[model samples]
Target: MRSTSRTEAFPAHTPAAAQIFTTVLSHGPLTRSEIAGRTRLSAAAVTKAVRPLIEAGYLVEDADDDARQPSLGRPANPVQVDGGRALFIGVKVTGDELIAVLTDLCCRIRVARHLPLTSRDPGAVLASITALVQELLTEADGFGVAVHGLGIAVSGDVDRAAGVVRYSPFLEWSDVPLAELASLATGLPVTVDNDVRALTVAEQWFGAGVGLSDFAVVTVGAGIGCGLVVHGHVVSGAHGVAGEIGHVAIDPAGPPCHCGNRGCVEAIAADSAIVGRIREVTGIEVADTAEAVDLAHAGNPGAREVYARAGDAIGRGIATVANLLGPERVIISGEGLAAYDLFAEQIREAFAAAAFGSAARCDLQTRPLPFEEWARGAAATAIQSFIRSDTY
Candidate 1:
């Protein structure tokens, strides 16, 4: 376990407190007046909520000379999250390994650990997580702070409210009580979330999607995942699944997806599909996505064609999102961006061809966020839960 200075709990545990904290978090180092203004909360309410926060150390008052303003009653100082007051652990469970990190309240990484997994069973995965959390907790010990929460991110259909991994194709898991088990093992509050959604929360607050009211984070890699933020909130469908663009059928006769659907974008454009199709078309016996990317870069006709088809599929999928939501931007991301050079043009062209008139105007930008960012996303979810629970 990592060590840190044990700080007091957040003073305001109410919903209003959470709201005020988040407002300061996203747009912090702002005076209480500024906080009330941005959150649209009355100054009285902000004052009531912030006093305890300052006392608890979850929020701090900045004493910088230049930032001081006399007219603001100079009565209030700018408040920001005390990144060092408490610690949190975030673990991203992948098919092959668990990536864990210890983060401060501001979600900055202090330590990172990667441990390979030999089994995909719930019990086995939990064991790995428990061990990792213990190690991080020990590390937190040195810093003299208590680890406040834990966040785990998994792929597939997850019931966040239930804290269960309802379905995770990558891990071959279903109905796994991951949150309860992790919390039991670590003796800390646990927050479970869909990997993509967790990543979306991070983006909403700290990454490329920041400051955008409506945007989509479309990931292309093992699976084609899309996270939609509508009017500044991530939409989790009633059934706990939303933005499953991978299952979006783009070609009815193109390829078969594991979801038992034909012509799904994932079936046609996912990394596995691209690699497998390249082998069928070129008879080159490609081993993995890297080999396939190399073949395409080497100017092999079949490999290039394979990427073209995947790009076309992605474009159509993106167009569908634009048509449905009318978002202001679509941010393309994920490991598949490594092959973007081979398919960028195709993705753009196909998106243009498929988009409806007005929908086509939304900004289309691509960014490559690594797994570390995804792990940071897990931290974001914990922070969200910590703050949103009171108000929501």
Candidate 2:
């Protein structure tokens, strides 16, 4: 694999420069005045910050016939990130598969690959990740741009700052120094983050949460997860475990959770929980979420009830998040959205019933993000790290 032994420093040295560059990346081609307005920076500051980025070929100006001429006392040329200037690699690790993507500086995915996992062991998963990165790196060679960094997203208690997987329930891992391992294997700087938080970064930069300073992302699937962007920053709690809506215990007398709790949101709504519940309630062998969804769609009342319960659990989880942080919007995504028809009403009703006074007004919308997007979210983190000089 082609690797850069030397770190490629981003030209934006100051926070203001990074902020301005990110503004253009997310909402460009935009005029300098627009960047200034969005970033709340002065026009002069935007110009000063943008110059270095443009000189480094990370930002480019476009000609507009209608643009005001600088000689006329105004600069009206719009600027945008040069997507082809740099490349990045992202990998999202799940219990059964790994999803990887190659993205440019703008976080636009150029290639995507999925590989099933034969084993959940750290070494095996790391090998798979390395192979995938090598494939994407070869693809990057075609574009002739160095792959600046790699970001790996995993579910559960990931300590991003320490680059450790404190615990991942699905993979049965704990305190695995994943970033260092991957960096050594691929010879590329790596950023490790929680899967949902990684996806939240993508949303903040290019998806639903764009232009919003406060929002939340709630994902329901193999595990229930939440990501919060409060005051324009992704909230990683003091213990690196914020927005963990999944483990919130809602019922003391209900289903037992793997976390040694009863009726936790994840225990009730996660895919495995729903599937197990369906089997126990209906006395049928449902192999996976797809099969369970089919049974529910085929008018199996028991199966439908299982999904309804799952939905209620999810809705209550969302309401709890809203009542606490009071985000302006809550985006519901993940693989579990496939069965939305089975549980949509329950989710809405439960949320409405549980949400407190003004919290009920928070907008809740469903966006079905494919697995590939989660991988791209991983890529977004790499882009963020590259720009902010946080690479491993």
Candidate 3:
């Protein structure tokens, strides 16, 4: 286990300090006035919050001749977060693989590694995670900065406050105290969250969801997942589980879900679901989702029909989200996008058909994010926990 004896607390603990830091990290190199304007804090407050950060080497000011405002009697030099101030580790666990990355404080991936998982057992997965983190920690030694925190992204009902994996269908796990175990093993403060929500945090601060007050991230792969951002905040719901559109039942007569439900979106659209349906319909003895896609791409009518149905289910599920929350955009992503051509039209058509009047106007964007990006998203959560003073 690594040592936490050298762990340092954030320079400032006030809400404004965290807010200011996040603003710079997201849309940075801004002057004090601009920070105040964007964060809705007074210039005095922004200055107060920025001082300790600058002194701590977390924020650095850069000369900007073009930003000089002589009329205001200020240079308007911009301040930005120092990406090298510290490092972090993020791990994204799938049923069969582990993706881990070493990241700077700005959530930029400095180094990454991928390991195949031979088992989905909690203990086995934890051991794999411990090994990967140790590898990343060794990489961090070259940077001469402490790895402040570690974040683990798992697919399931995760209680961030409790640091537990309440249920993970993909891994067949229940009530696993993943955060506590990971922290104990790696000797770094750990933040455990739903994979989709973790990815949403990264997007909200750095990726597609940036500058948007409301957006949704819909991931299609081994399982379908959704992460929601409303009014600039990622919604975790009162129970710590929200935006589970995959379980939204769209057809009562449809296939059964592992969640013990019928006609759920996941049952119809998840990678495993699609593969199984393709096998049933085409009797091609396909081994996995890749083969299923190949069959569809090769113009197998049965395989194409299966993808069409899955796309419809996914579309209807997205429509459900739009009808309920009315987000500005829906980002569709994940490893499954490799076969997006098979059913892209069906998804759009079904969404357009089911979505309410104005809700149908929501933009649907496709982003093909590899597992490494998902690992980076996990790192973003660690950055978030560090900034909020939740992981010391």
Candidate 4:
């Protein structure tokens, strides 16, 4: 961590203040009336909350030249977040690598770095994270601002409230007090959460989920994970594991999952599952998912069949989510999208066949988000913690 003077705490802590600020963040440069209309707060309350924020440099009013867009019938002054007020660090820890980013208060990435991990041990991963965060802290120094908090997004069951990794199959970790350890190592506040949920927060604020209250983000990669936003709140479930679509069983006797279940969505559609199936069906020594995709693209019947089966399993899993939550849209993403061309039609067909009635109308949009976006999601969680005083 860089040696810098302590910065002051955020000025607004009230629920209303957080709501007002987030509203402006997603749709900023809004007049007080617009803020009040969106937040459902009284004009008086909006003024009260906006005062300290503007005075503390967290919010700024647009200048007359830019604010006066007469054609739009907008007011002369609109308040917006001053993104340069502070900085945050976000890290996404995978089994083989770590992705980190330094972001402004608005969750915009300023610097990003990647480091390969040699070990999955908690201590080893913490050291790697510390090294990456230290580099970003140095980058923040050039901007002459403080890095307020650090957010780490990890796979598996994460309890954000406790800041612990209760279980992570990819990392083979359980009961790791990650937040305390990272905070101790880097001397910054820490927030740890499930990787997909962290990503959902970013989407809700600035990505595809910005204006929608009901949507799902399903990630297909080394693992299959889903993040859900229902009625404008990210569902964490009662035990920090809400959207485990990967574990949802579709076939009773297909293959065994690491979670001790047979025929789970993960067992059928995860990258490892696809590669393993391709090797079994073709008797080919395909080493990785990339090779499996290549074989399928090369017109290998067995490899193509494996991808089709995986796509069917994934489609069914998504249908289950739609059946239960009835979301307006489902965003499909992750590295596994590399072979999307091979199975795109299969997924749509299977989903159309399985989804019930109105659920079939749900939009299924595919988005290819890089690992850096996942790290940005982690930063969004850090910003959420800072604004809500959830951790600090």
Candidate 5:
């Protein structure tokens, strides 16, 4: 538990201050001028905002080392976030397990804990999450910093503003008020967001999407999910459902989806979909994605074809995203990348065939993000909420 007597608040309250601080947090050790440039704020505004943060110990200016001085004798003192100033907790809930991480103000993971879930009942999951939070909170006590906030990442349709898990197919959940329940149980301000969007936040701050204003994160595994960042903002559409690439129906005659749609991307490309397809095609008793991948690697033509078809479906989904958003880059990640060798060519080929002329130019890069990184993304959202003063 956090010490009740230790009262602390972020110094800068204005939006400009939050923006400046976030710039420094993400791209710092940046000079004041660089912060101003990146944030497009006036130098005076940047200085004004940075002053309070620096004074409050959230931002730190580097020492005036002569070696860092420019040739013109101007001191280029870089400013950066003091990560140790505060702490946060992040929890990522999957159908089978709970992943939690203790992170600092700068969103660096300090400790990670994994707990297998015996049941997917909302109450059971919430209890597990509460217990995990308490454990991490006790761990934070050793760091001597206040755990300011907590963020929970859930899959499917999550209403972040309302702090609700609208639906999670894997967990068979609907309209679960997770954030409110977790906050009440754990005594910490909570931010609830879709798992992929939370990961996008981390990407914007520290991963492949850094320095790119327009990009998409396409994750392939249990479900085909996408997170879109347009004009430097992660889009959460008016209806609390945005970038749902998994439901894009590419083949009407294909498999039926749990969302009651036929031939949706997830129905064809997700892990279970691939596993089932391999079983049907090869008559092999593959238990999971690993066995399916192994069959393809062992020169099973039918299994390899199944992966190829899944890749084609995923590529078409990526093309749809590119056609609509024209993102500068599309980052492919998730556990499914373990079988990337089997599907890489098919994905590229299908994407090229499906993408429009200019959209085809979009860079497609593969990045392997582990479950721990997804948990870190949840922490990033907590840090985001804390700095922006949207505590809950």
Candidate 6:
């Protein structure tokens, strides 16, 4: 395999250089003119940015014999990010486990490690993260690349710029300076972001939302989450809590949420919510989400009803995003799709009914991603950070 594990500091320090590189990363193999057009930078600026990148071997000029369009004497070669230029480590910290991945400059996973987090307290979780990073660093050594950065993704409000996890209900954390601690332990630059937003970064760069100017990624599982990408940029918002559709209230008297709201989408659609509601209705003493799903699949009306209501709430929440942003598409994802057959119709129905006018035309599609994929998303954030892309 081509190894990107040996890269040191990036070749260009200019913000415009990073911007041009990111444009190529997303829409690559373009002529210099195409890069300039996509990034809104002058031809001279694009040339200046691409020069050092290509020389440093971080970007490669392909042998495309056609599509020549440049005033420079060069054959208008297509430039692209060399995927194997550097390695990054991304760890997605959930309530019960730490999922980690090692990826190259293109955010392609080279290795993955899963470690169960016995405790959610910051102290204990940090230890687990350290161990996981050590394991991956050993793996990276074999690839002959130096890992440059680490990205840790958690749920709730995260100040990415400050590298602070302000709130994470699942972990019962507040004001945790996670990035600084992780950097100290792992000896790398660190980034902390909301898990869903991290996944949206991956989607923006490599998945369903590529080439899209506007899109919403709604995640359903232990918690309800949404990542909004508008104008080819992920909306982290000013307070770093822009696309929080999980808290969108659908009913005044339905269920209570950890956010202290009634009938919020998360309160209804989250896995715990469904399990709790099913146990309340079925009285079957279900132990976990798996058992609750099994009961629903076993033709239990009460269990099925819980999923239906959850679906309806999620649908309404997605509709709120559609009505507000009018994105080109709404991607329904996360582990919740495991029960999609039970409530997919309800979600579709509720979204269609709640969406207003032209907003209804927005496409709703399902993309199933396991927890490992979420870890890959975290790695993608690290790549974005290392490249200094403003969009990430």
TM-scores vs. true structure, each candidate: 0.94, 0.97, 0.97, 0.96, 0.96, 0.94
Badly placed stretches (over 4 Å) of model 3 are: 4-6, 64-66, 70-75
Candidate achieving higher TM-score, 1 or 3: 3
Compose the digit string of candidate 1's lDDT tens values, residues 233-316.
898889778899999988788788888989999999989999999999999999999999999999999999999989999999
Give me the displacement of residue 215 in model 5, in angstroms.
0.4
- lDDT (Cα atoms) of all candidates against the true structure: 0.85, 0.93, 0.91, 0.92, 0.90, 0.87
Clashes of 5: 0
lDDT of 1 at 288: 98
Q: After superposition, which runs of candidate 5 have C-alpha atoms over 4 Å from their true positions?
A: 1-6, 67-76
Worst 10 residues of 6 by lDDT: 1-10
- Distance from true position, residue 156, model 2, in Å? 0.5
- Cα lDDT of model 4 by residue, 195-264, tens digit: 9999999999999998898999999989999999999889999999999999999998979999998999
Query: Whole-model lDDT, candidate 5?
Result: 0.90
Residues 33-117, candidate 3: write the lDDT tens digits: 8899999998878888998999999999886556456336543778999999999999999989999999998899999999999
Per candidate, the number of residue pairs that clash is 26, 0, 0, 0, 0, 4
Clashing pairs in 6: 4-84, 5-145, 5-146, 6-145
Residue-by-residue lDDT tens digits, candidate 6, 175-200: 99998888777777778899999999
Error of 4 at 48 (Å): 1.2
What value does the lDDT take at residue 60 in candidate 1? Answer: 85
Candidate 5, 157-212: lDDT as tens digits: 99998899999999999999888988888888889999999999999999999999
> Once superposed on the true structure, which residue ranges of model 6 sit more than 4 Å away at CA?
1-8, 64-74, 389-392
lDDT tens per residue, model 2, 36-121? 88999988898899888889899998875465455335578888899999999999999999999999898999999999999999
Candidate with more favorable, higher lDDT: 2 or 4:
2
lDDT of 2 at 328: 97
